[model samples]
Target: MQTASGDTQSRLPDTIVDESALDELLSRPSPALQSFIKTVSSPLVILGIGGKMGPSLAALALRAAQAADHPLEVIGVSRFKGDGARPWLEKHGVKTISCDLLDAEAVTRLPEAKDVIYLAGLKFGTAQNPSATWALNTLAPARVCERYSRSRIVALSTGNVYARNEVSRGGSIETDPLTPLGEYANAAVARERIFEFHSRRNGTSVALLRLFYAVELRYGVLVDIARKVHAGEPISLATGSFTCIWQRDANEMILSALALAASPPAVFNLCRPEIFSIRQVATRFGELMDRPPRFMAVETGLDLLGNPKKVCDALGQPPVTLETMLRWIAHWVTTGGRNLGKPTHFEVRDGNY
Candidate 1:
């Protein structure tokens, strides 16, 4: 793991890293991303840019092109319902397009671009509205693929598509059989299949990024644990261990995937190579917050983990390590940090989101 600047570590303040500051940090692209951006063209369109990962990712793409001395028009597409995500992205020089991906005509009318990053999908409200989840997860991908059939696409996928793997075996690889547990996981698998089907039929180049939890101070597994620990609540260990990457790392790798797109869509697991234990993560958060972490469950054999060796080999590992994220998140949570009100539901052992 890459060590972050010790100066930044030593000077950590006792306050929440505000939204703007965190966004700026996440938008800073790595050296690998800059080199990869040199190979791509302008007018890159990112669908579903309103999501947690999308805004920074869109910003990262724009920054990478600038750093590489390339002029690029980066467009972020979303419904623009609320959350100020659209405005924030636009402020970072990302062209904003308001369109609901579910509306087929709206999707068809979207501008043609040389590259596409599909980040649109449903996950959080799967249990109550399974139909909506299926529609967005599977149907939306099909529509996006059809609209940009010829363009090189890098679609965001979830690690939940794979069955829980034993901890000793490390994590699930790209080729592992997907035996996802609930409606949400199954729908995610369907999402991948839809993209694969279209990529095969239209001869479109595609890359499926199977990413686990991507963490920042705002949301993700690390935030969930940090929040719980800071509040002096007991953390659950039902899921045992999991994998995650910093938001900056995930954003850079997602942009780099444009170079890996293939006619027969290639799959790559996106997460830190290490499998992190929930108890240890919680305990670390406790230490940072001056509170002892309370545990509620035993470590199970099953865990939602992924093997990111392929992506690490291709795009290089993230500069921010898990320990770095823990330190950042701990400080953020202990000092009245704001959450995006989204939970990872990492406690779900039945695979239900």
Candidate 2:
């Protein structure tokens, strides 16, 4: 692993045995992250800390703070709803608050902080109840921006905001249009627009990160492919290529991006620079799990992808590689490791999810 000060270290585990081990791995801060945490002020507020990536991200920030011996207090706010994330975050020394972001008064009553990380958004089930998705994706951000107008905010957005592009073009750059396909994607664009409006109006410094995917052992694009291959299900190649960053790397970059926040709201596409072929990834998983993979559909030559050059130039390339991720995910799946059962639905070109 590469530290923020540009030092090299070996931290990758051979295999993740269970959730405990997996959480530790995900929450472990890299040297780069530890170094960055020192610069952050106390009471780093993380909104929507009850989602799939929230607990580990909060833990990573806390671990980084501890490593730097910085007196940084990490507070995570979410409705929680009895999810296992609240307990895990509390156990990791992150202060937890149960509050619905949609309640304007509830958001106003939250503690104050100069630095904030926004992670709340709805993607799946958008087709079933799009009004809920729009309210959460658009309204919640509006409230957060209004409350944290003076804070340096790092907000999570999705690459689904971009229209499909040719594979030969590498991927959609940060300047690409936001005319994406479905309700979920349009709502995501509205989320970004809301943040931008608030930032411009209030002179708030903000960074918008359009992340493609964040992969880990339990659930992600990698796990989705690995499970299908292991079960001998036909994999689709219609959306032939995509991009992702390891969850840890994504968390670290998101924290580090606090420095990139600015008036007018700097935007960056967050993911590994390399474009990955779905067919190749499935075949690699098969080799690792000793299973022959089945495939269906053909490459459409158009897919939703992101170009990470801007962010990679600002922060270094993510240290974790594709081979390491494949090895870790394959081992976890074959060993009866637990899965979150939440598919990424990466193949959905219609942007339904």
Most accurate candidate by TM-score: 2
lDDT of each: 0.85, 0.91
Worst 10 residues of 1 by lDDT: 1-10
Error of 2 at 60 (Å): 0.7
lDDT of 1 at 16: 38
Q: Return the TM-score for each candidate structure.
A: 0.94, 0.97
On lDDT, the leading prediction is 2
Error of 2 at 261 (Å): 0.3
Q: Candidate 1 overall Cα lDDT vs. reference? A: 0.85
Runs of candidate 1 exceeding 4 Å displacement: 1-17
For candidate 1, give the lDDT of residue 143: 87
Residue 276 shift from truth in candidate 2, angstroms: 0.3
